[model samples]
Target: MQKPSIPRGTRDFGPIQMAKRNYIFNTIRSVYEKYGFAQLETPTMENLSVLTGKYGDEGDQLLFKVLNSGDFLSKTEENDYQVGSKALLPKIAEKGLRYDLTVPFARYVVMHRNEISFPFKRYQIQPVWRADRPQKGRYREFYQCDADVVGTNSLICEAEIIAMINEVFNNLQLPDFTIKINNRKVLVGITEVIGATGKEADFCVAIDKLDKIGIEKVNEELIQRGFTQQNINKLKPVFEFEGSIVEKLQFLTTYFAQSETGLEGVKETQEILKYLDSYKLENDHLELDLTLARGLSYYTGTIFEVKANGVQIGSITGGGRYDNLTGVFGLKDVSGVGISFGVDRIYDVLEELDLYPAETGAQVQVMIVNFGSEMTASGLSLLQKLRTQGIRSEMYPDAVKMKKQMSYANNLNIPFVVLIGEDEMKSGDYTLKNMLDGEQAAYKINDLISKIKNSH
Candidate 1:
């Protein structure tokens, strides 16, 4: 028989893994809802037109396109294939898996423009696909937990997103994280200062790699992209700028004196920092990172990226302000700011640090031991009662041996196991075993429910 396997960069989650994954999702969802963001979901696939061009050239190259279903080859000319796959793709594929939630949210807002209120706050937790090679903490298919508010340009929206980031990591018990904030305007300002004004996009793209490829390669790339050595020299201070948030802002203010757009970005970053001061963040610290140039072309204003304090992982979360995302979908002037929590990477961090709660993977709080056919009926009724009392539970399905039933419960780390047999059934009481401590006791039916619920 052929060995069973799944595609690379994909995973099959078992019971324990799913339980832990759900914990991460639930924690994030609750925080999103608490912040007045309503849940939204979009289809996993979007039209090629909607997804293409939105992510820039490299991003477009990574989109997973779905081929036409039937007779797909009929419309394709042999010469089209001979020319190149890129030339032939549009002939066969019309749709592609969604690359991210933000773009689709933009499309949704435009399509339902009539229904949505201004400053629509929505949260989406969904899987997105990319065709890129995957490695540790990076998968081709993974979930993005995004919260965005559209139709407003207030800095409060940006501030609240920062607060939400703090809340999420704190709730998840993440020990240390930094919320790096920067503005596209500030990046644009850098380009302006360096005299790379017309090539701002190329400048941002090259500088965004400072963390990935380091400053030397970034400088080389800037040179390759036609930035003069003189202009590249002007950008060195931006790479070297460091201090408290205030100090960084002061530097930018002086440096961007010539660029109004750059100064506007400086003011925006300062305002966001001031608003952030009102909150008491536990695990998240705000920093004005001059180098944080989110490479996405759509970002127009404030941008954010999050990194785990001690873990050597790529950003676990990122997003930014987009002034014109919806305009592309025919809904003009709808400004939105948002952030995305990278679920899979966060899971890896939690697992590597062993931070998940001990009981997170415990699906059933109680398990009833099946004594035999004679007692199965009573066990079923007792199991039903436990469930009705808001307790998660189950009974051993067959007339299994006592040792086997107890072993099964132990394996799942179920806290309590109730035994129902001739004596307990006749006495109108149940035998409950505290699996963790091996403490045994007897209780009336109602009392049994109370004890189990309270103990858990």
Candidate 2:
């Protein structure tokens, strides 16, 4: 028989893994809520029309398209196959697993335009899929914790989003991280100044790879993409510019003096930065990065990317202002800004840095040990009482060996164990074992509840 295995780039999270993941999700959810973002959910699959052309050519290629059900090939024309995927994809696959939360969100807003409040604030925590090659911190199936506000062009949303990012990592106790901010308009301005106008998309695609491929390689890519060596030579100074946020913004002011569109992007970025200062994020944690041209074609204004200072991973969080995203779906002129927390990558960073608190793995507060059928009745009564008092307690289902039952509790990382026996039932006190130090003490029902609650 062939050994059973999950598809590559996917994983089956065990109890402990689930517990840690929940920690990350709950932290993000709490922050999203505190900032007035309500929870929202989108279907796992979105129409291919809704999913495509919004995320740029590369993103469209990575979409996990679903085959149309019930003899999918029956409807296809013989000539469509000769023309290839461009002609055949829509015939065979009308739906695709959502590539990200943002696009699906735009679709939702358009579909329910009248149902939701304008400048709607919503947060969605759910899995997204991609067909790209996956490695550490990148997965084909993973969750994105997203918070967004639509139907407004306010830069306050951008500032608030950055503040939320700060709070999330701060709550997670991830101190060493940077929030890199940039503007897509500034990128356009740079292209114009360097005489690379009309090649904005190509510039973003190449410059976005600067961190991964380094400058020399990036210059090579720029050349390959039809940029002149003069254009690259002008870009070199901008790439290597070192300064504080003020200095960087100043540099842009002078560099983009002649490009009106570039100056507009610069102004929008300045407004966002000014609004963010009152939030008082830590020194150097928020930075102005000129080279941060977020590759998503939809982003029209301020763009943000976050990196864990010490971890060797890609951006843990990123998002930007999409002025025309909803407009693409027929909600004309509605603009919004948002951010997404890459949960898989965040979990990887937490694991590598040992940031998760010790209590994260202890899901159940106490486990009631099972002796046999003889004592099962007393155990049942105690279990119900503990649960009624809001204690997370469970009992072993089987009348297994004492060693075996304790092994189960240990494996589950149960912090405490409650023992009720003939003697204890008669005495009206049960022995509680502290799993950490192997200490045993007798306690009544009320006392047991207090101890478990206090300890955990």
Candidate 3:
């Protein structure tokens, strides 16, 4: 028999893992709902045309394409394959697994434009696929909890997204995190200020790696990308600029004074900061990070990325503003802002810190030990009553040995076990045992429900 294995970068969650994951999802969903964002779901695959060119060069290469169905080679020109698979890809593959929720959401807004209201607020929690290499906290398949608002350019949306970020990590009881904010226009301004206007994409892509590869390699990359050494010299101050959020903003304001677009980005950042100051976030801090250029080509305005305080992983949440994502899909002039929580990475952070609440992984609160066939009926009756009371209880499926059934309960960490053999059934009561303390008592159905409900 062939050994069973899952694909690399994918995972199969067990019962306890799923429960902890659900806890994360449920917490995010509740916060999203409180913010008035409606839930949305998109298909796992999207048309190749809808996905390509949306995420920029590196992102496009990471898309997992679906092959054309049924004798795909018959439709391809023999000569096309000789050139290269990349050259012949379009002739065979027409669909791809979704790379992220934002692009699919853009398509949705355009297709359903007439049916939905303007400034539509929506939240989506779904698994997305990517063809990237797998590593710790990076997966080929993972869930993204995304919340977005479209059709409005209000800075309020950006501010609220920051608040939502704060709320989510705080609710999860995660340690200190920093919400790094930036503007694509500001990056554009930086390019213009340094006289590298035409190479904005290359510039952003290089600087975005400042955190990963450090300044030396980044400067080397910029030089290789054909930027003149003199222009590169001009960018040294930006690389070195640091201090409080306000101080950084002050420096950027003076630095980009000559670049109109850059100044506008500065103004937008200031406005967002102004609004954010009115709210208090317990564990998260907002900071201006000029180097925080989200490498996605689609983001035209504000960008955000969140990093956990003490974890050694990438951003657990990220997103930004897209001015006209829908325009690519034949819808014009709509703007949107969004953020996505990286569920898998967040799971890693929580696990590493041992932060999950004690009850988050509890699947069953109680179990009924099956003494024998004679007592099975009585056990089933009590099980039904307990379940009806909204208690997570189960009876042993078969009349197993007493020791074995007790072992099952112990292994499952079931806190309470009810032993309903002939003696207890005759007395119209159940023998309830507290697994933790090894205490035993007999109680009527009402008292049994109350006792179990009140037990840890």
Per-model C-alpha lDDT, please? 0.90, 0.91, 0.91
Q: Candidate 3, TM-score vs. the true structure?
A: 0.98
lDDT of 1 by residue, 1-456 (tens): 899999999999999999999999999999999999999999999999999988888789989999999998889888997899888999899999999999999999999989988889999999999997989888999999999999998999998999998888988988788989899999888889999887878888888888889989999999999999999889889887779988988898899889999999999988887787787654347888988988888999999999997888899999999999988888788899999999999999999999999989899999999877779889899888888899999999887678888889989989999988789978988999999999999999888888987884
For model 3, how does the per-residue alpha-carbon lDDT over 52-169 read when each residue is reduced to its tens digit? 9998889999999999999877778878978998879988899999999999999999999999999899999999999998988899999999999999999999989999998888
**Candidate 1, RMSD to the unseen true structure:** 1.3
* Model 3 regions lying over 4 Å from their true place: 282-284
User: Comparing 1 and 2 by lDDT, which wins?
Assistant: 2
Candidate 3 lDDT trough over 10 residues, lowest sum:
276-285
State in Å the error of residue 370, model 1. Answer: 0.6
Order the candidates by lDDT, highest first. 2, 3, 1
Tell me the spans in candidate 2 whose CA falls farther than 4 Å from its real position. 282-284
Cα TM-score per model: 0.98, 0.97, 0.98
Per candidate, the number of residue pairs that clash is 0, 0, 0
